[model samples]
Target: MEIVNSAKEIQEYLQNTRRELHENPEISNKESKTSEIILRELEKFGNFNIRKNVNGNGIIAELIGAKEGKTIALRADMDALQIEEETGVSFESKNKGVMHACGHDNHMTMVLGAAYLLSKRKDELSGKVRFIFQPAEELSPNGGAKGMIKEGALDGVDAIFSMHVWPDLPLGKVGIKEGPLMAASDHFTVTIKGKPSHAAKPNEGIDALVTGAQYVTAVQTIVSRN
Candidate 1:
């Protein structure tokens, strides 16, 4: 696919879309409204095969080119974190205690922007492009990616692409790498089996809280030291 090269020209569209998403953020597994908004906006392009409700509120939109080539996929997550809006901005989250604090709003806006640009030039492209709006990314141990993959989200796709917002980075700056830039994240539970002890007891029983803290501190050594 060729670069659109007019990202700056579409600045206002992107900002308004992102602000709308940020104001009405939805948490994991509850992105029905978000999914609706994405579908509604994607329909404006009027050139794609749109699939909705893929493994619970996931959306897949495809733009097939006139020529024959490989199919590439672009993905975006549509979930917000559990946080209250304290910034007092006008477009702050309407849903109390739920906000797009992790910048998923920007992620969705970017992918939608890409979809718009690609659809505009679908006649000149040489391959297919898939746009995925995934839900439940904030939940671990059973994220929405697993569900989408199980339902064949990546099937028949030659390559995939995704984007994320970095901390305090300049506009249009991109980072590329061959190897994985992030470590694998998974959920873990540590249940220390210790007897209940009194607060002032010197050596009555084991202290689970102190033991957990020590375990955490010990684990930090792996990252802090060589």
Candidate 2:
């Protein structure tokens, strides 16, 4: 992999994008405004095929190289959390009760920065680069990645690359791993039905709250022991 030498330029560009995104935070599956901003930025670079509304506000921009080679994909999610912005930054979120606390704004900015750099050097590149701006990543049941994949986002792609901004790690430093870099998250919900009884009743019906407490404790042990 060829590394770009313009780290300072890239960081500045990413910071501007991140602040803009942070100010206009949008929730999952509702990133119309965010998508428009990304589209506009991508258009300015030139030589990019922009496909909007790929999977509910998701965008895919393709940059074909002069020479034929493998096609690699870079993904960045663009969704905000429901929590209110607590950071007293000057560019705080304008939307009420929504924030980019998970660094998704940073992720989007990084991908867009890379896209900007790569688009300028398209002729020097060997393979195609697909820039994916995905939405609804924080959504449950099904995420934006799954929706994009269902709509053939990964078609003809050889490898996928993604990264998250880690504040814990030192700035300008990158941490990489070969395998099992992150754990796969799996969520399961169990609902128990029981008859409601009066508070004074001793043994009238099965208590659901009691069972739920026990179930939660038991399931936690599974992960703790593993």
Candidate 3:
């Protein structure tokens, strides 16, 4: 595949989008404002069929070419983390206790940049391009990707491509892997039920704090031994 070499232009666009997203960070499924911004930008391209309210703030845009060919999908997640922003940038997040530290802002911009480039060359492409703006990617238990799939996001898709911004990679370099590029992430919470008693009386009640500590240690050993 040939690389797009408009680094200066793409960087400028990416910086603007990143700053705007950072200043107005939204969390998880509640990304209405972010979705609106994305929809507005995609609309400006003038040849896409937009679908909104897709699996809770998810957006899909389809760009069909003239010739008959396969359909490819590009995905970008648009949710921010729950951490407080410490970056002293001028466009820092206006929302309290939320930030885009994980580079979803860049993800959206990169895909949009690709879309902009592809839009100019629509006549040359033989197939369709679907841009998926997904939400709740940072949410646990259920993410927007699963929700969109449930809503038929992949019904007619032939191949899908997604990318994440890696800070460890060099500025001009790109990394690609064939299979299983990352590990599966899982979060667990263990709650202990115990009787509460006065602190002055020792051994009167089951200490949940101690039990929780023991359980954490046991979980660590389980993973280590496995």
Candidate 4:
């Protein structure tokens, strides 16, 4: 009950921070401004031993508890997608051609919210809490997590927890399971070439657009059909 009440007290803080982040979204590998804001907020929290610019705009913040125990980590992604905002919200993305479409703004705010509450309740804790703010999550095969780990983000961590916002879930509800909650992602690139045709010509040249669309439709069903 105490923790719940404390979290409620910071509800406004969480919302405002989330909105601030959403308004100025940055794409993968370009989260400098995002890292600055996170650093500022963590500094205001005042108990974390923060390491900035870890593996390109990543942040690792550690908070020691009152007693000696294990270390735990909480992670949040810090990259936005290359998308334009059409949500029409008052605090929609201000950076053109980039948007927090993946809810990373929310994820960062949630981690900061946890940091805020934990900062105030350090006396009750027995272990250390590490907060990891990683960038370039949208870039696969070479995401920021690899660099963060190389920078010792998990040097002394016993366990780590991270979560994402799911639009499929009901409002104010959280879903969790024992095993993995998200599926692995794979990236691929395909290029199709076609001869150029005059605008007035009906069928003189091959239609690469149609070929690409057909390929996309066929590829989309690979997993389901297999």
> Which sections of candidate 1 miss by over 4 Å?
1-5, 196-204
Best by lDDT: 4
Q: Which is better, 1 or 4, measured by lDDT?
A: 4
lDDT of 1: 0.90
lDDT of 4 by residue, 107-199 (tens): 999999999999998988899999999999988878999999999999989999998999999998999998877877877789999878988
What would the per-residue lDDT of candidate 2 be over residues 111-198, giving only the tens digit for each residue? 8888888888899989899999999988865788898999989999999999988878997799998887855565787889988778
**Per-model TM-score versus the true fold:** 0.90, 0.90, 0.88, 0.87
lDDT of 1 by residue, 130-173 (tens): 99989999887688998998888899999999878887678769
At residue 190, candidate 2 shows an lDDT of 83
Q: In order, how many clashes per candidate?
A: 0, 0, 0, 0
Give the number of the best model, judged by TM-score.
1
Least lDDT summed over 10 consecutive residues: which range in candidate 4? 179-188
Specify the poorest-scoring 10-residue window by lDDT in model 3. 1-10
Per residue, candidate 3 scores C-alpha lDDT tens digits across 1-226 of: 3445754556787788778877888999989889988888888877888889999899998888878899999999999999999879899899999898888888988788878878877888888999999999988767788989998888799999999889899997889977799556777777799888888985798998889999888877986798
Task: Order the numbered candidates by lDDT, best leading.
Answer: 4, 1, 2, 3
